[model samples]
Target: MQCPQIVEPEKSTQARRHALWSTCSPPHQRNSPMATTCPARARVPLTLQRSHVCQCVFIRSPARVGAVVSRAEASTAERRKTAVNMRTPRRRRHRSLTATAAATAAIAALSTSAVAPALASDQPPVNIVEMTPELTKKMQHEVDTFFAKHDLPGLSVAVVTPARAGSDPVITTFVAGTPTLGSSELVDATTQFELGSETKVFTADLLAYLVATDRVSLDDPVQLFAPAGVEVPEWTDPQTGATTAITLGDLATHQAGLLDAPPNLGAGCGADPGCENPRPGYTQTMLWDAFAQPCLNGQPCPMYQPGTDWLYSDWGFGLLGTILANVLDPVIETEPPAYQSALDQAFLDALGMSSTELEFHGDGRLATPYKADGTNAFHWDNTNAISGAGGLISDATDMGTWVAAHLGYVPSTAPIGVQAMADTLQPISDITMSCSIPDQCGPAHFQMGLGWELHHAATHDVGAAWAFKNGLTDGSSTDTALAPSLRVGVTTMYNKRLSDTDQGLPLAITLLKLLVADQPAPEPAPSAAPQAALAESGQPTAELIVPGMMAAGFVAIGLLLIIRRRGHGRRSTR
Candidate 1:
């Protein structure tokens, strides 16, 4: 049957009628709000799984039904008015607007009233993540299990919630385990730890900020901006046998044809004797030399032509950092050299990343890295070479704020920073991925964005679902991810290094699922039957549609009156 907006009848009476219908109707006929909760699926013959069974519901006596529905709706409207009249009323603000503002507001209202209906796609998914004692208890147990599985010294996670009306955004900072095995120092959100490649997001964003300022274009050739005496190399793709122009954008998107690590990188007592060690760093000269060298592994990057292959390369970002450091040139005055100091000013200080140090400042507050056996290791730092790629330290709290800024949940950061964050989330590279077409079911299939990895559950658009970056060093593991559409961000830092940060991924994914997943379908409605039936059918009832329709009509009428009056004034003057 066609979906027609029917007047809502008396809630309880309607419920009784619907309940009778539901009890008698064939098992396949009842409406289900979500496929996940549908009972009809159980009755489906296994052989007929590929086919869909649609039960069409039809009602006779249209005139009689309409008459009853109209009268019930009238009574409901009256009861609503009576309730409003019984309540204490507050003064509503009605302000006179300037001529320009009035005209602008009228145009805006006209556009919104006219356009919003056509664009409404997803139902404004009700996202009520309960932080009840029971929920917290379960979450804590999961967190404990995750830490135990990884044998982490400690783990801290910060979840920034979506903003609600009349309430500030909520941040739940949960910390578990010990910062050190022998010591009693417990890790918390405030505990400092190296964020590693998570810093690359900021470096990529700095390039975006410069673009927004018209200082540089993403299309600018990397060779034009590389530091003096540093030379980035050319890559001839073995598969395609074509050389492509590399740009700053390529570096940001991991398409700059660079190796995974700088060439000359080795383990177990190298020529310089620090190569195999966990804390070794390189200078700008070393970085340039490494970029000029050939690829060590056969994955991609310097091994392949730019944009022809997708390779996760820290060396690509190292090139980007060199360009940014030279192009920006000590935007902040700090004890560090020109390049590092510029990075500090442009991002670290600008983002209020006080807890994130550009280099090891000998700060005792740093989280001590622990060996798998739980013995202490020297905290990792960076030299000018690799520091730009994965050399920044941050805590869970600041990382959350960084995520918040990226998702545009916070306006405290610089506007350029916001733009850059948005820019970085744009999916640019594609993995060898194939998904269920048309409706888009299946795993994310691993898409790449500028300095970020994108989770494409809903859409492939930048910031549509989640944008993420993860980091791992010999000392720590960190993951930062944001879902802009849901206005949620998750960040975690752990003292012990892990081969995989899948433990933290589950926590972050769980939080996001709570934000985006459809509400429990089988749950009874807060209102009685009429409204519940409408909701379950995916059809907005007359009662729900009428108020909005009325409001828009009223606003449009007001706008017409104002515009006419303004036109009259202008004509009279003329």
Candidate 2:
């Protein structure tokens, strides 16, 4: 069993970097037989467990001791299984060490026989399933399996696929569990869930409708649409002394450099952001007050150069929605305009989204919202001026139809005569996010479209793109994604609030990956260190690596046992 000693170079950086000997052999045999070709030249096909860090496998063979088989070389079946079964993370950001540990344990709980799949260089054409009875059952199965594993209150899933020849587009809906824990009432396709920020998509669509109708332009300054004598503050560069007015487009694309929420909200919440009733008390007058407070007297209202950076601002969208409302009818009184009703008459009703409302209907169909700890959560009512930002309550059916309209599937009853729907999806800003929280920034960056966030395929590489949005409220979480190229859309709604990683985005993206078989390889998720922008928009971080390390370890052990048995057989035959 004595192996030749391998001498180390005094300071060979390249050798050190490429050395696998440390783990490949005992201390006495620091030389990995992999460093050089084996004289035996036998391709023994050694298999090791998958490694999440590397996203590949190392083969230990008699002839080639350390050959690497990348994710691309692995079987497609394994790839599909891993993609479908990956654990969902609670948040959108990169995972923390504790979250990573929890994810690791979850993955370890999976059947030990499962193998981790690699990101294949060339993915097969996405298998877009047609909406059929059989597909409905399959989709139901996926939904059921997920609910069985999680302790959430309820879920409703909707998927729309391109129709077969001579048929309309196929639509399927799946509902699971009850609206509340231990409730006899069950969730259905029509069960309503708060849309959260997905309402931003609707708000953006409304803006597009106005633009298409020639009521306003994207480049028009916000002050132009504001009520007379109300000021929507603009950024004045102190260094250059040049003043730039915020535009409707800037607000829509989150480039307005506004606060995430207006300052009045802080004053209402006593500066504690986690307060449940922070926004319901906010009104149009408060919004106007926020707009008017900038650079007054000695108060400093510093804004980054508007249109220069991307920041998520509920305050900006609230302002944008208010402006759009004023476009419909100029606000003459001090009272808040009925913006939500105006929005419905203007477009939501036109789009046949009858189930969607800015306020709770007090009906049984609306699922009760629950916090993560299963406590009843205060329902958010955005009936005030800020309704456009996170106001709408919707169900799988209505939201699915809304998504269908985005993909040119608008029914005759609810037609978008102008090109406004398409305009809402045009990329307005390039998103480049930096991670300051260690291990919490994911590789997903976005291009801001009016109300939508766009996830494109690999960077600098041409492939399909998905327009998606994640919505969260105190009680509910929802995710919506659509691939226009494939004419496929998915919406996942949950009754109780889930962590960013554990929310519906992972499930929705997983379903998208299943239906869109040809989706490009996902961009590599960033590590704990500060990293550059995504090279390609891949699957969300939740889908790719969470279970990989644990599954790979199991796979490696199984492969070793097989290798040992085969070796004994060869010796006996010889």
Candidate 3:
């Protein structure tokens, strides 16, 4: 029952390192490289419904305990400490060590190698989700339930599993509903949906690719890439009266101390309050104005010292897009397209994300966004400057490929190096969330990776972590979650922008847990009160509410009749 001790190859050859790092599920007795190291465990049935999942890692130790970690575990711990410390301005480099080689090696050695064999363990067997009649019906049933229960206009989902022996990585995709309510056409793999802030991950991916290629550095000042006459904001510590310039790392991790949105986002709004929308996008001139003086009181004021705290800011990411555009424009041969073209060249195109784009020029494939009431909703338009903040439009297939790449499933066609994708998942800053009940939070830790939200469950091996991101626009929403150790990635796309209280997030998170650990999903604890709120208020449908209202009305009528009868009896007695 004991997992055998794995002996690291002395040479650490490229192939050996790859084999050591490519674990997807629990150990199997055949085919998988990990089968030789980790033995089998009993299978656990999934108990949680599709709507109760939260962001947590489920790691089941092999049948035996006391397994020794590989050599890389110590170095990874040191690097994580260093990466966390680097968030301070005193140590501003902010680059973590590359993917933990030994920790991954140990995980690979401990995990079941083949996807099918994972069925024998407490892990659901990772299978390729195709558009077969059976799978389509199953997915459609789930999608219909969500639509009826949660008010979703439409949905498309994709999940990626690591490759099994003699097989390619398994990608599962399913779509239900139409681009618009009246349209007869149902959404498919190619139908594009606005990604919203999910675009930030792509921006971060571009940054990582550039850094991996040595075209940029994490510590590079935002000022370095700005076009002439454009100024980058400076942060002044109010108490210390010391100042520092924001760097790309600070921007990527939301520690740049910038406002959530640029002040000029409402520029030229005149009297129309609704004109404040960023969907029209920020122009270069407006972007420059904000950068020159972020606070607009003739001051380049930042809320706090750069690199000192975490504050999610669309303005910061917008500025990042501008910087990346500046860095990429010189290298572009023809008239520079939207900054997205650079992203296409960097990874999207290479990774088979042909349907993903920042700009939609009458693409027939673009899904019609809808409101909760099934009415048409506005699709966000992005200018080059703010495109990276929340502008990319993508489909389930492309999103799946992007998530798969993070788990070391980069296809040979992808010229972009795997290290580039890995770099984006590196935890750069520790994120402390306020939990009313700290113990309920368990040993789960949170961090800001390049653009991903990193969640580490109780595991000594830092490599065993999950990274995820959520996106929302006026009309649509997207959620993507990945567990690299299990090589599992799950994403959901909705035509309607579901509320935070909706089941969209819980569904994705729950699906991930089901795949990663087949054990019954625990209910959301007090720490996940928001998730608990989902059961009560998350997009209740008319079918659920109308009957209750009818019952209440019937009861009220009966009470009124009783009162009238009592009054009649009193009059008779008189």
Candidate 4:
């Protein structure tokens, strides 16, 4: 290395060359000397090259180093300036980040909140029940069996539970028979049948509605509302000689001493040669006049004192209906209209029972009334003055709506309580029947309510307690029953005019029992304090209850899972 002396280039020349090389050199090799030794042919044009390379090199070296130093200083100053800028508003920067995070979280929270209900909507609704395949099949089978056994031409039945807030009721329908005996038109749930005495229930309800609205008072004397100069027959107390007036309650409760049917209903009769009009021809006015007559001369008397006993009297109910019409006329602003017709539209229409009505039009949809012998030939007579007692025509679907309303399962148009309806369904009288003639009577105990019949000790052995009513006319037999204990209700409308001994009522009972066969026993009544203490002390109470058992089971399962997870965590740690 000491063999030759290496003279350093002059500062100006070195600087000049450095400048020239700095322009040509790649950024990575700018400091290397070998970058300058390229051939002239490989070099850039001399004009474009550095003029006076030695001088250029000498001038540019310090300038290049200074420029580098200046750049480094500027970069350091920029970094310091950035650091200062960052430190000056440290709290503000932190606050900004925190605010941004909070804003982002709030936005995310809002989005999540909005998305939850949408997701819930997307999911299937809860608390809804679909008819199980087994239930459907059983219902169908039962309906078919009934048709086959009864030799029905066509029949349709609709069973509905009370509707829930956001869910429709479980409506199970079966259509098995034809609408007409000859036409083979399939019957559907919309098929209409005369409701018969079932109309009495609606009429009674309307009367109750009027009473509820203060349109009429139950204790108001019927004579007050009776047509002008129409004297309502009165009953006199034998001891007091005081005239007893019949009240609206007497008529409604069937204690008005009215006859079961019109008096001398079949009076005008003669031999075929000298024929007279038969079938008691009593008009509404005539019935009212007869009611005005004294039981004996100059004394007001009734069969029994008002509200003394309950008798099944169509006349009593008829008078009640007439009074209801009079009371409702002024309030509804429809004077002298058919009271039954107005009641149907006001209450039933609002409830969405579009298929119900007070009259049957002979459209193809109306089911023909028949006799018990399955004879389609039957008279379709007007209900006359007693229309309110037995004139409504409805189908199973519409009846279900009415039942739901009675059960407080549907909102009522009139402000009446379920207790009021229940009161109407209570037993007001004891009806004893003789079994001498099977068609005429049977061994039955009937308790009469306002419009309901309480059947005690029914044939069925399921301990059936029912609020029932039956309607029998020339060609139609209709029955409706509600079993509150079992939470079941039924409506059976037969086109045929069936006797009390016919299969309609029995069939309805049997079907109702079957429908409720699987219902759980109702909850046991709460024990008395002593009984409760005994139960707590492990002594037998009246009932052994499983209170909160399901909830306890779920809690136990959750605890077990938690314990197992803890055990697993301990084992894994080990």
Candidate 5:
């Protein structure tokens, strides 16, 4: 009879052949026999008696197969099954894992890119001459003691020196206390605080710019800038009753015979009430009305001729700001801009003081001004309209840059040279104000510069006849000084009110001494171009001294490896 066609499935057929070959082998010699027989069966089934032979192979192999044959077939089938399983689901899992790993790697890279350097912690080690660790610690301790004694909320101090070619200027900064009592934020190098009368330095610089451009002269009379129909205050010689005019130089040096406040302070307000309107929100119309008023009942007329005596006057400085604004307009030709805009453009911008500004409101990083009692009830006075004299907000970091410029260690935006900065710090007039009695003024203990006060003979141990200024409002006090004798500069800002004679002056003296006592002797003047280049570049010398950038790179690389391993783990799961 014709054999029924044996349509063995390919997988089963192969398994049967494997089993048959394994059974024919001796138990002890199974490996050699099975290998030879399996190939012979494979050839015969495909070539001759294909249908019947294939059917017989499947049936006979299963019955007579050795224990080893069954085991071999089982093993082969299991391996094939495993391979199939591995190809489908396993392949999909591996692909999913690869995608996850790639995504994780990408996210890690993005995170690294987004993170900025920790500016506070990453400050390069500056080479401040003689700033030994011991001295730094002692200085910080003294500062802390002073703060506690004076009940101040916060303070910052910086010392900068001239830079030599290929070397960074020495800088040592110390910060103390919280920026505000109610917050956990520590004072950083960048905390913006009110600058008070320290603003005058920038104003004086603006005037220098005007002078450089020939827009205004130092000797120009005040009447030249006052608004039309505004009667200039008559300055009668105390003995002669003869009127004298004040010049721009007189205003700049506080020798303009201007009062401490606007004349309207007593007229519109009341007698001895001048302080009441110290920062009144006076408009242009109000200023005009106030200027028109006659001298008060008991108030003395101009005591000294313009350019004869040096007296402090915010009004004179305010008028200077207005004149600067007007002079700058013909050159810049813009409308409705602040009087200080010229200063911002001509000086602050060129100095890379990106954070300094004439006004600060709504900026969260700003240190809150506090009264002596630590209450935030005071607001900075904005009524000056003439903001150049006492309206600036700045951080220690930016002030450091300003100090560098003053030291001639950095270039200024103005065309004025080192001699010009020196001129600003020179003694313009001998200050003869009484220390104890009002009219019993003594010989000059202080002198006036263009916009600075010269301590020709400071009463403090640390200070050495420095160029200085101090500013105070209701709850803010600031002092900035350049000790040329020591080649050091310092700035201190506090958000609390203290007596001018007590807390403010003493602190200034102490900081000046701390900075001067430890400074190294000045090196000879460096080559001009190289020093100028360093100043112009403003790159911190610490960058070259510290390996911070290298360390950051290594950290970034380790982060990548960790991210990669996490991705591999996720991929394996898939």
Candidate 6:
């Protein structure tokens, strides 16, 4: 068979630009040196791989330009699978590859097949699970209805279907409405959105990681990791006449009787002698100062005895980050802020979250935030002491990986990956109760996990386990939810600052329930990339399932076989 040839475009100017952009960065911009060789398999705790994981199948095929499928053989698939499943890259090779962004995107599009391997150290695996047509229509309707009525500018939601063999975590993403601010680009998988307080979950996860390794104890008093020279103004039990030290669990569960923030909130860093924010990007310093000056108006601030209260305090989390950073600094041997670097190691680097980062300023891209009134809102950043409170910047794609790990599906090579996830999901306190048993419990009854808030009664009624953390920021709102047993999680985010009556939280729950419905999943997966005949004409078309290319190839081969048989019959007649 002969194929048509395409002509090449003039490359005079393009060649010059490509050469310029491909050049390596200077010494100052280069990433820290990492080992030239990687280990065969990073040592992961045995506990990380208990059960229910959908191991990603890595198929290394020839990625044709302008194509979505790759053609590779058994040996190539094994090698690529080893890179992702066995050995997790120790550190990322941050390079001066700015010019290669487009080139990289082109290659990535080819690897969007279900078995695309995340071989490049910097590239997190991309998994696309084409959902049922009816499911797509249903989710789109829900997304559109919320955006239309709520006056939200833009929103992105990603759902993970029940995992099946021969695939990575089955992910389906929906981008709805045009963003009111920033580049006005359509909200998609790669777009970075502020994680808001959902960051606390990561912070709590870090603590759990440490606790799992015996490096720290959740029951230890807060003073254990406090910076030297900063005195934790003790709160004594009047009846016992002994100081009631604040334990780490108190902060993780929000049971610590601490203020939401010190002195001023949402104000710029002030140079005055007494200001909540004294310096930019100095969360640890500010956290230490808050405790050192744990008094207001020359008197100790109001703080109920530790473990007796359940007030949500961002500053309390800031203090926790400072403590965790101090403990993790020596262990990781990092020059950056200890806690921040530790987080990068556990999640961004080791756990394979390529699209996530701690800070946003001077970063590549950001989804602009807006107010409910359709006006621009300030882009809230967690540069100050409150980063542990809400400093994470991530996309729905990265969040899907995170969701998988928490659901005990995709375990990481990190020492405490699976254990930390379980610990974070454990219930710790009560938030509000359900209305199911009005006679036994009041309507305002709910449960709070280490980082996630538990939703029982209603969720249990549907035979699903649900938990979530609603993130609130001045410029953005984020809702992160989980359905553990059903193995589905969702992240709904909008640049718009949701007001009092916002439906973003409920919207996430509704979509999540639909994703993890009680009905059994179709064998393999019913969804595949739309074929020409099926997408175009109304005909009985073959479904190109999981690895979209294989099914397409089968259909093509069948038609060709019929053609050859007809040709032979004609020759026989002659």
Please give, for residues 231-324, the per-residue lDDT of candidate 3 as tens digits. Answer: 7768766789777998999899887877777877765243576663554544666666776554644455566577765667888888787677
* Deviating ranges (above 4 Å) for candidate 6: 1-131, 165-168, 179-184, 264-268, 271-283, 292-302, 330-336, 361-364, 411-415, 429-444, 459-463, 503-505, 516-518, 521-574
Query: Model 3: runs farther than 4 Å from truth?
Result: 1-144, 268-281, 294-300, 330-337, 411-414, 417-419, 433-445, 458-464, 500-504, 519-574
Best by lDDT: 2
Clashing residue pairs for model 1: 257-302
Local distance difference test values of all predictions, in order: 0.55, 0.61, 0.59, 0.51, 0.56, 0.56
The whole-model C-alpha lDDT of candidate 2 against the native structure comes to: 0.61
Evaluate residue 161 in candidate 3 and report its C-alpha lDDT on the 0 to 100 scale: 59
Native-to-model Cα distance after best TM-score fit, residue 133 in candidate 6, in Å = 3.3
Worst 10 residues of 1 by lDDT: 42-51
User: Tens-digit lDDT track for model 5 on 449-555?
Assistant: 88987775345654356887777766677778778654567777777777545554456567667767665555554332343454456644344224554555566
- lDDT head-to-head 1 vs 5, winner: 5
> Of the pair 4 and 6, which is ahead by lDDT?
6
Compared with the true structure, what per-residue lDDT tens digits does model 2 show for residues 245-299?
8888888987776766776664445556677675666777777778655432334
Which stretches of model 2 miss by more than 4 angstroms? 1-129, 132-138, 266-275, 292-302, 331-333, 411-419, 433-445, 459-463, 500-505, 518-574
What lDDT tens digits, residue by residue, belong to model 6 across residues 279-329?
A: 244545555566655444544533666765456777778667767766766
TM-score quality measure for candidate 3:
0.62
**lDDT value, residue 75 of candidate 3:** 62
Residue 529 displacement (Å), model 6: 42
Q: Where does candidate 3 have its weakest 10-residue lDDT segment?
A: 40-49
Q: Could you tell me every candidate's TM-score relative to the true structure?
A: 0.62, 0.62, 0.62, 0.58, 0.61, 0.62
Q: Rank the candidates by lDDT, best first.
A: 2, 3, 6, 5, 1, 4
lDDT per residue, candidate 1, 1-574, as tens digits? 1222222222231121110010012112235321112122111010001111111121222232222222323565698999765543121112223444565566556544432334334433444342333444455566677777787777887666543231223445567766667677677555678777887887877776677656788888877865567665666656886766788877887766565676654421236654445224455555556655556534433554566555667777866776677666742211223545555444444343455656464745567786555666555565455566877887664565566556654333233434356666777777552222212324336667778877776543332367777877667777776776556666878877654434344455554554444222434434334556656767555555556556666666676677667556755885
Error of 1 at 208 (Å): 2.2
Error of 1 at 161 (Å): 0.9
